[model samples]
Target: MSQAPASGSIPDSTALETGASEPGARRPYLTRTRMAAVLGALTLVLIVVCAAAVMFGSVPVDFTRAIADRTSPDHAILFAARMPRVLMGAVVGAILAAVGAALQALVRNPLAEGGTLGISSGAAFGAILAIVLTYRFGGGSAIVPAAGFAAALISTLAVYRLGQMHGRVEPFTLLLVGVIFNTFWSALILLINSLVNLYQTRSILFWLVGSLEAPTYGEVAAVSALGAAGFVWLGWHARDMNLLSLGDEPAHDLGVDVDGARRAIFIATSLMIGGAVSVSGMIGFVGLIVPHILRLAFGADHRLLLPASFLGGAAFLVAADLAARVAIAPAEIPVGVITALCGGPFFIYLLRREGHRGIAV
Candidate 1:
């Protein structure tokens, strides 16, 4: 999946520019001024989406009363219910998209994402297993995060290692790895679900479908803190992300700690994925769709792509959640359902487009 671009195309700046020369000046569309403007606009969009998510649920909220008067009934609906869920959605989206952007660069795969690479499946399996264990054993759901993290780390490394041939992640190898890992984890999750009691099965199934329920400030804070940490880690290595696209041998020759950087990045992304799946189930496509769109728009400079993907993803998931809340009125659907509806077609389209462009069959 190393999208090094076919020789015939006037490849985007992503394929052509080395960050070593003139930095942001080489990409006319991705200059420093333009990057800042794009990021600012994305921030504004996220804010607007968040506000809309808060206000436009099935129950009409007295928006001003909720904000100004803590005693009002609307206040509970806004602060105690909607706000935390919306915030959680935003942070989860940010984590996915930011990490996805980094993975695309690291894997040199235009189509790389958490779902496509099996990270989400791994985390979801971990969280699902933890839920089953907690019910069978006496421990609370607090163990979910640790379980999810460990599983996510293992699955991530397994896929990343298998996907890489020599130093590069071959497109065919990555696709096969995704299929194998995803099928394996999903089957295991299903097996666990089949054995559990009705109540436990319901819980496991909810996560499988992906929901943003049990809205609470604690969940928001936990997700935000971890997501922020991962964001910083990826941002710190944005330069290396760029260099890695130049090939591992070339990158190492240019002073990149290839092994160390790859390890750190996988760990950071796995941490974020585990935390998110533990809380929000398997919310799909935020990681895949957001970064792919941003890279296309901003030319794959991880420096610009990461932040833009974060903001765009926040807006996207927030909006998707809002749709999930109201799309069926009073009765809401899973957020994952909405994302899959959007992403499934997008994924097929991307594959078809890639095929037409001469990507390997």
Candidate 2:
């Protein structure tokens, strides 16, 4: 006869297999010195990409002239058009990626993402609603973003509630509800578009597909502020996230407030996702791609993972946006198209790899 395990002692298989006491759990793979170097490299790459973006618009821009004279036409195009769009792309990408990393850690699901939670779909619906209302009945400038944020929060709360079973949120249930919500909201958006005029319909379609075109300074500033706050909050809770990843019971035993941490991170991610969707439209896969790649490169230590996701996400989206601009020369494809093209294949690959394990992290 085998003896029962002690009440508080973690079993070896349970602890090690579930990421509670894995190798390198005591210390992350990327040290501070290495992280700093990586960040510096990513930043340098971002700067170079931004410069290229500014220089390669539909109309030719002289970089030398733009730098020399801010008053010149080339400078006007660079500062007024390209700079804001590029900055918005970076901000949106960082927020999405960081939020993705946090959500994945929170639920212990590799496939968990903002879209998987219905936040993006809700946000898109809200944005579309705002556009329709603005066209039908004039509203203030803040209506679109405010509506989007509100809808996102509501949808996330609904998912949270629906995912709860006996006081615990189940990852698969949440994902299922999210899929339903996304389908519903997408149909609603299409229905609304059908009722609207041609111009409004075009606008809604463009936003739904996503774009980094003609972003204004005000929009960029708002997204940056919100994204910064979200990033800081997520980073501060990174260690807590690591604890939560080892299943809820183990996390509680480790002194982590599992519920509180999940709630806080959910809200933070919602803010970031809503802000990005409101500004940049419905760009997908940034969150999915960035976090997974970083996890494969560096171990799943949120302290390093979250920040690396931010930097890598910023660089990735900037590069994608650049491709969107130059791929068709005078005519530009939406950045969302490019991301989907990249993310779709990778997503399939992940599905196949995780299929046996049911895609749970």
Candidate 3:
């Protein structure tokens, strides 16, 4: 094992991109000031992407014309439908991405993602159950998020416990445990689907794949607030996550209450994941794709990566959702399909890259 860097010493950025024998290994750690600058640039990028996504859907909305004519279809379409969808996409994307970055830190596994922990699957199952119960009995849309959050927290706790090896989480063991949970939860979702009517099946499919079709302002607001809380809560643990990257023993040596911190991180993750999946369905890879890309460019520092991942993820999903809209024209594809298509090969590449040796967190 590589020796832990001494107290207060910055670990070499080398092993990360710090591949030995590569000239690029000498790259400097990303400073907070620089990270602030990057966040500014990322914000700009997000705004531009949002504008583009809003402008170029299946039926283009002319904001100028809509502004001049208040009663135009463009006005309703732009404000009522498209804007909410875009905002929801941004909101959910940010939630998933930011959570993914923090999650990787929690597990000290770079390959760790939202789905890797089974939170997404657990959330999906909860949402599905809510849908089924609503139709069978009688309820409102509110039950869905509640059910999803409950299921996600329970499933995640199960995985956390199952992943432990002698009281500590083994990164690979936790990942496998999550996969098993995902399969179990997914099977339940399928069983429910088989028993449901076609309408419910369509709903189940939406939760299974994912869509940003039409979200209400209320849903958007609720999700945004929850996501913001998750972000700040995780950010509060940034230094601990950084220490954890060094290894469990080293982080403990540095005074991080590893078990306590991990528990808190998992709870926050469950909240956001349940909320995001509740609104957006199983939007697979926003977490995997966004954080990994940002980590590559920004180094694995969660302080920067968390927020940057949020912005970058918002931009990425808005753009992807736009593509899903246009990719078939009039006929839309599930946003998850677009992400899965992109993330599948990316996942394979990551598995292969990290297959030889574990990432240092």
Best by TM-score: 3
Lowest lDDT 10-mer window, candidate 2?
Answer: 21-30
The order of the candidates by lDDT, greatest first, is 3, 1, 2
In angstroms, how far off is 358's CA in candidate 1?
A: 4.3
What TM-score fits each model? Answer: 0.89, 0.87, 0.90
How close to the true structure is residue 101 of candidate 2, measured as C-alpha lDDT? 93
User: Which residues of candidate 3, in runs, are more than 4 Å off?
Assistant: 1-27
**Model 1, CA-based lDDT:** 0.84
TM-score of predicted structure 2: 0.87
Write the residue-wise lDDT of candidate 2 on 23-112 in tens digits.
534233446866777667777877887777766876788889998998999989888988998898889988888988998888777777
Residue 200 of candidate 1: its Cα lDDT? 81
Q: What's the lDDT for residue 252 in model 2?
A: 94
User: 119-213 in candidate 1: lDDT tens per residue?
Assistant: 88899999888877776786966789888988889998898789878756786687679768988898999998888788888888787778887
Q: List the residue pairs that clash in candidate 3.
A: 14-18
Q: Residue 311 error for model 1, in Å?
A: 0.9
- Count clashing residue pairs per candidate: 2, 0, 1
- Tell me the TM-score of model 1: 0.89
